[model samples]
Each structure stands twice: as C-alpha cells, then as structure tokens.
Target: MSYEECVIVDIDGTLAEFDAEAVRQWVLGEEKQWLPFFEHMAQALPGVAVARLVGILSAQQQKIVICSGRPASYQHYTQTWLEQHSIPFDALYLRPDDEDHLADEVVKKRLLQRIREDGYQPWLVIDDRQAVVDFWRAEGLTCLQCAPGDF
Candidate 1:
C-alpha cells in the first residue's frame, strides 16, 4: 500500500499511559529505575480511543506505524508492550540509542520524512503533544491530538 494510506501512532502520551513517576524517571534518564516501570507499562492497558483506532485501522488494512522518540534499545520491551495491549502495527521506527540530545519534535519530523521517502504516505498521526501534532499538521500531515486524560 502507498504511504499516504498509513496511520502513524506515538507511544508514551499517545497510545500507552504512563504514571507521572514513571515519566519523571524516564525523562530523568534513570534507565535502571525506569526499565522496570517501562516493563509494567508494557502490560498496562491502552486507552479506549487508541484501542478503537487500532481496531478500525487494522480492519481497514491500513498500515499502522509506530513512530516514537523512544530509544531503539527499548525495542523489545516496546514490542512486547504493544503485543500485551493487543495493538497492531505494521512498522515501528524508534530513535537511535545515541540521539538522546535531540528533541522529540526533531526526531519525529526527521523520521516522518524518512517514512515518506521510503514510500509510505502517512494518512494520519496520533500524538499527545499539541505542538507535535500542530507541526505535523502544518507540514500537511493529518494529525489527531490525544487528550491528556487519555494518557
């Protein structure tokens, strides 16, 4: 299928819900402490909106892509997390382990561009940050902002 028909989703504040403490630890780069919390997040259920979206997209045969700022080192846990939530995905592109210095928006823009170049037309992007979704929208990508309470 063409890239334009693809739906890209973010994790963290978008699909998976994380407690404040867990988020704080992750943002603080406390990997040792955050790893366990992240594992728990894997088993944590996603919000209804995300679950419904995943189901509808999967049924339509649309490509469901995960484009998160998460480092690639967490790939295994992230995948397991998605599976545990029964989220369907066609592709997942995470940040390289060394790009911790880059902002999420920068990483997202770059990756989204790459996805387009790779021949997947992104039809929609679901993200939690208003700014991120605004940026995507400004770039002519349709984006949905996930409500904060849903995170």
Candidate 2:
C-alpha cells in the first residue's frame, strides 16, 4: 500500500499492557536482566481498547505497521503474542538488537525511514510515549497517544 494507506502502531503501552514501575526498577537495578524482562513482556495482555481500534482499522483495510522499541532478537515472542491476540499487521518493525542502548525515539526514527523506504507512506501513528508522539508529529505524521507514557 502507498504511504497514505499505512498507519503506524506501537506495541508496548499501546497494543500491549506495560508496567512502568517494574520496567523502571529493572532498568535501574544492577543486573539489568533482558531475558526475564522480555519473557515478562511477551506474556503481557493486549490493550483492549487499542486492540479493538486496531481491529477496526484492519477491517477498514488500513495497513497496520507495528513499530516497536522491543529488540528484534525477541521477534518470535512478539510475533507469537500478536498472533495469539489475533492482531492484524501489514508489517512489524522492531529495534535492532545492537541498538537496545539507544533511546526509543532514536530507534524509531531510523525505523520510520526504513518503513518509508519499504514503500509504506504512513499518514498516522498510534503510540504511547510522549517523546515518540512528539517525534512522529515532528516528522509530519498525526500521532494518537494511546496512554500516558512519560516514562
């Protein structure tokens, strides 16, 4: 589909439930466990309202492009979660494993360029993070904030 037909969607805190305090502690802790964190996130329940919105958008034939800050190394888990939830997506973009240290906004900006290069002309974005919402707006796309994502 053309760029105008594409709609960008975020995973954590948007399509999926996210625990900010748990994540904050994980990030601030000394060990910084990734596997356990990913495992926990993989099992997170889908956001009912947002998932319903996505389903409606899918039914309307809008291309749902899932762009997430989650590491690509755990793509299988993410794919499994989406499938289990029956969430339809035209494409899935995840942050590179090596780029895990970077900020979510930075990682997503690069991914957005790749999405454009791949022929999706994204007209709208659905995200949770305030920073990411601001970034998408800066990039000239209308962003719908699904949750309060100050963290």
Q: Which candidate should be chosen as best, given TM-score against the real structure?
A: 2
Once superposed on the true structure, which residue ranges of model 2 sit more than 4 Å away at CA? Answer: 1-4, 27-32
Q: Candidate 1: which stretches are off by over 4 Å?
A: 1-4, 20-22, 28-37, 149-151
lDDT, model 2: 0.89
Q: Candidate 1 — what's its lDDT? A: 0.78
How does each model score on TM-score? 0.85, 0.92
How many collisions between residues are there in candidate 1? 3
Q: Give residue 77's lDDT in candidate 2 (0 to 100).
A: 85
Global lDDT of each candidate: 0.78, 0.89
Tens-place lDDT per residue, model 2, 4-116, is 47989999899999988877765425445667777788789999999999999999999999999877888998899999999999999999988877888999999999999
Q: In model 1, what are the clashing residue pairs, if there are any? A: 3-120, 3-121, 4-121
Instruction: Give lDDT: candidate 1, residue 50.
Output: 81
Highest lDDT: give the candidate number: 2
Clashes of each: 3, 1
